[model samples]
Target: MVSWLGHIRRISLTPGANQALLRKRGFPERDLHAKTSLEMAGGSFIEGFGVAAQSSTAAEATVTLARIDGIRRGFAFEGAAMAMAIRDALPLGHRRHVSDLLEAADDHIYMIHVGVGWSFARLPRPLRRAAAAGLTDPTLTWLALDGYGFHQAFFHTDKYVKRQYIDPDPPVPTNHHPEYAPHAIDQGIGRALWFVAGADPNRAVRLIEAFAPRRHEDLFAGLGLAATYAGGAPPEELAELAERAGRHRAALAQGSVFAAEARARAHIAQPHTETAVRAITGLRVTEAAAIATQSRPSGHTVDGQVAFEVWRRRIMRRWATDDTAADGAGAPSTSRQPSTSRQPDTDGVKDGS
Candidate 1:
């Protein structure tokens, strides 16, 4: 089954351009607050760009950001502005290391990414409520933040190969996106994705030069993008749990493309659920746990485990004990019972295809 991964666009600002970006993005003044507010609020780093999509199948996974209009607006903005924001926020000067700037900054830029949202116009009566409910999910917030994190990591880590990473810089001034062929325009999708990235028009050119569907595919294949997460873990155990939850999601996609497709459909319902719970509310293990309680519309069942569950179990494994009263073990398995959901065993796990 072919998966429809959305366009995952990442723009890393060239050094020394935060203030310019502030104005482009309409920040009142070049100040730390702009960066802080976005990160704190869990906003997408790239301004003006967003994603949209609608699917009829209950089991389908496709990238939503590819929502393209014949005329593009996001690319119309200047890359220099965003680059400047990153530059000013840092400790480094001309030719200074991006890591130095990030390390020296007040708060490390967490991450930036965007997930597709439901267009009220596109939604039917039923799914519309679900779309509106998704806004509050922490996992949704996590999805939005990743692109920023990816952009910054590349911006700071890579070293300059030649003055220009692209053989020739992008089309001057105007954005040149792909036409007939995909990878052609979105070359930046791969070019900027390398070891290091910065505020170079080449990256921008590579980014908008070709906007293709396959480019998004290339990004997912290149990095093996993991499951989306929303917020922080209170303890090491909780962090582990979140990772495990994401990994379980990843594992399902890996096992069978069909099963992965189904899970992808399920993801639309996930961000909101994970957020509604204040505490860990998933299976003990992503695979093992997800399978234990997975469910379907027809009332079918599948066992499952989640990244969050695995992480939690690793930490609690030593602490957890078997229940002698039920299974004849000494203590009770805290994981077998989830605090977040009503009926732990009622639903099938992520393994359900």
Candidate 2:
């Protein structure tokens, strides 16, 4: 079991504001040798660079605990109380938690923020009108994990990946994980969104709502890069995906037919045309369909005035605004990490830089 360390700072501003907030708030102004997108704790550091660590799901969170006995930083594992607190906090850093947080905090300023990014309900009337007029890219995908790491360098360690798993082709070891590297995919998406949102609420919301569930054809498809080749996705799902992509592209070309265009826009527009949603999720579309058939589920209602994605982005933007209102609460220090710590991590398990 590997020791796991997670960072959970609540920045009041988008990434850019991190520096100013940091300095104003009197946090240490450390400079990094290079600018990095995401920062890891004890779990993914190697040498002085970040290499192998990737964001993962709730289920995979235990992997750090599983492989490593009790976590040891320098020397001691966190006391029971501190460990429990960290465990409870891990999911927030791990997943792009939306629905649940928004629903729970609907009356709060954060919820209000979450709703405005892509939604007219929470949007400024002008932005809503512009969005209505089709003056925006409804669906934009920012690559995560390796994608985010391309530019900056900070605390993440590991300059080289010490281990590589040669994935088995399709129908992995179990139905639970029929794909090659399921956790890897989730980790990538989770890491990317978390990192991007840290700096840009506008882009973060779009990436989350429009492209987050990228593993789902009904979502964004750039996720295919993380696909683990679970059993092949349904052929019908594949066909439907193609149709959606074609229709989506066409809708975009047809001008500001907002709703129509979104419907046409393929939610899971995979980065790799060859990948499928099921590959990322592990479960088959049949499972989703079956669940739907079994339950006499009622469709949740929403104000149809705005696209779901738009509403979500608007909401996140508002949260960013609110965080900034009283001065950013958890913004990262835009200042650099101390130059004294530029070396890569030597541990092969945590960092691969």
Candidate 3:
């Protein structure tokens, strides 16, 4: 009986399939194949969200999530995380649905945490902190903001991408390290450009270049992750992306390594993942994944630096110093320096431009 109520809630709250349609979303139709691929991924996310919302147990949801093969499976897990997060935030008697799902689907932890960010975008402002409070990982929880940033860019391209808007103050829970939120969100927006540009590497590059130079590193990092993980570009295009990364090559490689690790951890095998890894970092998937694993921080902030950024810097440093495939010609001195600007905010629904 309780499961039935869950299903009812899903049916009422989930957006219609049309919402994922590229035409409806007003995204460019640069490549028919890429457009179709992203739209399908979006559909799979909706399907996974509904399945989790309706499931009586995390095990029940895992069964359905496992059946979703290939890269789409990660998106499904992300959607499931969003559903579990929403459930955790509600006044319902059941708690720890997110924790239980993580235990069963540990491989998808990256996607799952990002999915929780989607829940933050959907929930009322007051409930946002409650959702953040439920998540325990200090470093991984920041990925939620990345997810939130992606949601905003994908849904509001005009403002987030075209207008080059940045939230002056994102409403992140105080405990979630609101200071570094914008960088994470920019990473997500950068990732969204892959889809927004219809997987056209050239277009994606142009989009990132339009942003402020300081923002370029994080944006490029996001693009690398999307190009590697979502994988719409062919090998040549991947090479083009790396070349265009220019001074931010280390940042791009860092993001690609992170994506490679996420896919490897989830046991997801995709040709695009390999192609992007090779083109961006000139390393095999295993090699790139190893770098990501080796550089992971202990999840403790040091001198006000978030563990997540620390981990990213470690990866960037490795690529900067050790990566033979990367051209050191114009690499930035640092991946991301501290911004003197005031902290930013994102509502995920607003056209804050």
Candidate 4:
């Protein structure tokens, strides 16, 4: 059977093209699937810019960035930002030295790495290693690792790459996604933190906390996902990782559970749902599945995209409870009130589409 993403083929990455496509489709809910396919197609476009910038002279890279900047915003602002980031980082990345990429600031490297999310998978499967070589810089490792993780999770059914090493074992191929395309990307980004931190879950938590303190909770959800779906890690390790990821266990768990269900839904064969949950979160299969069921899309929440917004609120609320429990006085809540209806957080940062 054809995959969901296979249907649309590649769409134009130019802002005008996307705007026109959106208008032509009338931006209807039924077209959500097609819209997502086009959004991901931008990955190839952004990666091309990165590759072009590497081969071109500095003057050419500048020209490339300028051209990218002129394009209109499409499904997400990340596409443009990624192109720019790649343009800036190409000089260092072209050297094929991880240390050079690390010399650049974390923000620049991350934008470059995460921007390559889709292209990571687009590479001829045989060339993936050559493309990902020289990624040892710990400082910038998290983002590249996350981008690779996102690539693995988004395109493959299992964790085929471990610690900059791709398992010779091939992932079961199917046109399945664990969540909406954007959310799945986030989860992949988040999951990479675990591997980037040398597979130490607690270290991953600390890394996320230090790097993106403002967006830790949302990222923690992705960490939860990688731990769950990848398996093989000691269950206790994952459990400890979840605990250190702040007091947002419930919210983190919710994201992971929903992702598992989405993966199962997309696959033609039955998934080892319970086994994966127990391995990832130390939760029984039934309990984990229950959480997934609770997060089911409703009238207010449609699909994993909107569901993430609602789940994030739960994480904030759970954080408040943790703070209250830590101190006798209740912690001041910083989160917005749980909106019965709210749009996805598409700001193009940790929570962007």
Candidate 5:
């Protein structure tokens, strides 16, 4: 039997299915395939939240999540993670709910961490850290911030995307290494741009290009992940995205590798994943996944940098090296450095607040 609290949370927190509709989100209908793909992801997210909110146990919720097949299954697990985190953070709620779900859905750990970020976006300021308290994986916990960025960009399109507002004071844990928070959040915003542009490669490129040049690396990384993981674009479109990435191509390829690893780890396979991986990274899904795993940093931090960023840089460097060698350049550089050119600030773009 569902508790009164659970029932109330279900009704209050779960968004109506229509909320996932392109028209509802004010996103353009670029292509039928992209629209359907994004809407399906949104719907899966809602379903996951509903199932978790109403289920009595984490195991019960896991069974329901497992039934959601295809790549959409990952999104459902993400939603379920969000719901569990929210429940655990609420007053009088079970503190172990999020951790319990984590234990049950071990394979979806990455998506689950990202899902916890959704709770941060939904909860009151005081409860945000509480929601994150259960995450023990030091390296993966940063994904929650990525999720927070996605939530803000998806829900507050104008402020986060159009205006390109950066949070002056992000609501993160006191000791959560606040310095790298914006980059992680920007990665999420970049991912949201994939949905916002309706998976149109040209549109997505234009959106990322609108940001400051410095932000392009992380944004492109996010876009690569979305393009590969969510996969609405065709081979040609994927190729176009890769070409448009230019200097940030390495970042884009790195993100694709990350996405490939995430899907491979979760045991979910789709044709789009293969197409996107091949088009963007020139590697099979397995090859890209292997690269990501092999390049992963052993420690949570490396040389005073977040291991996650270090891991990403390592992947980017590998692509950079390969690209140089393929271009007949004598020796490959150690890294792909960001361009130093300044870009005109968009109308409403603000540093913070």
Candidate 6:
């Protein structure tokens, strides 16, 4: 475990630090070209494990694996062996569960240094903070995916000056990659938070609340993921943070469960899975997975991803309906809202870009 933490630390540092860590882990290469955040992370991890090939396709596979691991780290919280080892680790709570969003944000910043150099990194800190604070429980479900999509578009900008917001409705990419021309609605709001709050959680939430009520879910969810993952909110303050965004405590808990389940099934090592899931949701892995299976949308098989979404909606529907009624809130109508739907394989949430 100590050795693994060391490996993560090296990768989370500068690009040169990543190269050095790979060598220490017994890889032959002293350096490699990883031109994006995902690639830098994936490449460092894959190269350390001695699995990367010479082809671009092989590198992409490594990047995907690294991303899966990163999300798992977010879910694992203090249980994340590597993140816990960091000296400056920051903790954030989401109702029943706790996570280290600071570490997650550091991972992002580290990637920026590798892919876009110092200038780009200098400009994104505020945007990243606002995005984190602007999110809510329901919106978080999809905006987390939107962040992935945003990363794809953001990575393509070789120059910081080239960075521009894709309008709310973007033209579909020829390759059909959702992240390519990210739908600015979800991704746009998340990204805009940077200008509003920078890294200040308090300011971020205020900005998030200023959005129209119809957009509250998306804004709140995006803020939750970003704040919990990157904005450095203290654990004790999480409940207040949610309250400020006008999110119900129960809804926050449910969204976290979804985030946790999404992260867990992505990785093979289950060292922390049972403990983390039980701690957050009070259910063992097998029991939780079974519950997920029962909740599957009609006509959809109960895979990890499908089950995760199903359980998320089941928990969320209870709170959203109650909250909307109690406050006379005009949350998005039930008809078009994916959270209210039973389409087992809905992409509304997980479609990152």
User: Per lDDT, what order, best first?
Assistant: 5, 3, 4, 6, 1, 2
Q: After superposition, how far is residue 300 of candidate 4 from its true place, in Å?
A: 8.0
Of candidates 6 and 3, the better by TM-score: 3
Q: Kindly give the stretch of ten consecutive residues in candidate 1 with the minimal lDDT sum.
A: 172-181
lDDT of 4 by residue, 296-335 (tens): 3333243433443554444333332322221211223222
Prediction 3 global C-alpha lDDT? 0.79
Worst 10 residues of 3 by lDDT: 343-352
Model 2, stretches more than 4 Å misplaced? 1-44, 47-184, 197-199, 209-353
Task: Tell me, by lDDT, which candidate is best.
Answer: 5
C-alpha local distance difference test of each model: 0.24, 0.22, 0.79, 0.40, 0.81, 0.33
lDDT of 2 by residue, 202-303 (tens): 332344344323322212222221111111223344323323333121111111111111212212222221223222222233332232223211122123
Candidate 5 lDDT, 1-353, residue by residue in tens: 77886688789878799988989999988878999899988999989999898788788899989998867999999999899888888786578878898899898888998899999888888888778888887777788888999999999999998888899888664364567788889989999999999999899999988887778878998999999999888988887777778778877888898899999998996889988887787777887888788877755567666777777777776665544322222223332322323221111122321
In angstroms, the error of model 5 at 178 is 1.3
Pick the TM-score winner.
Answer: 5
Q: Give per-residue CA lDDT, model 1, range 180-208, as digits (tens).
A: 11222122223223222122212322432
- The C-alpha RMSD of each candidate to the native structure, in angstroms, is 22.2, 23.2, 6.0, 18.8, 5.4, 15.8
Off by over 4 Å in 4: 1-186, 263-276, 279-282, 298-307, 311-353
Point out the higher-scoring one by TM-score: 1 or 5. Answer: 5
For model 6, residues 203-285, the per-residue Cα lDDT tens digits are 65665455444444544444443333232334335434544544333333343343334433433324343433333233444
Candidate 3 residue-wise lDDT, 111-227, digit = tens: 988888888778988778766665677778888889989998998899999998888877574463567878889989998988888889898999998998889888999999988
lDDT for model 2: 0.22
What TM-score goes with each of the models?
0.21, 0.19, 0.88, 0.37, 0.89, 0.39
Candidate 5 local lDDT, residue 204: 91
Off by over 4 Å in 5: 1-5, 173-176, 322-353
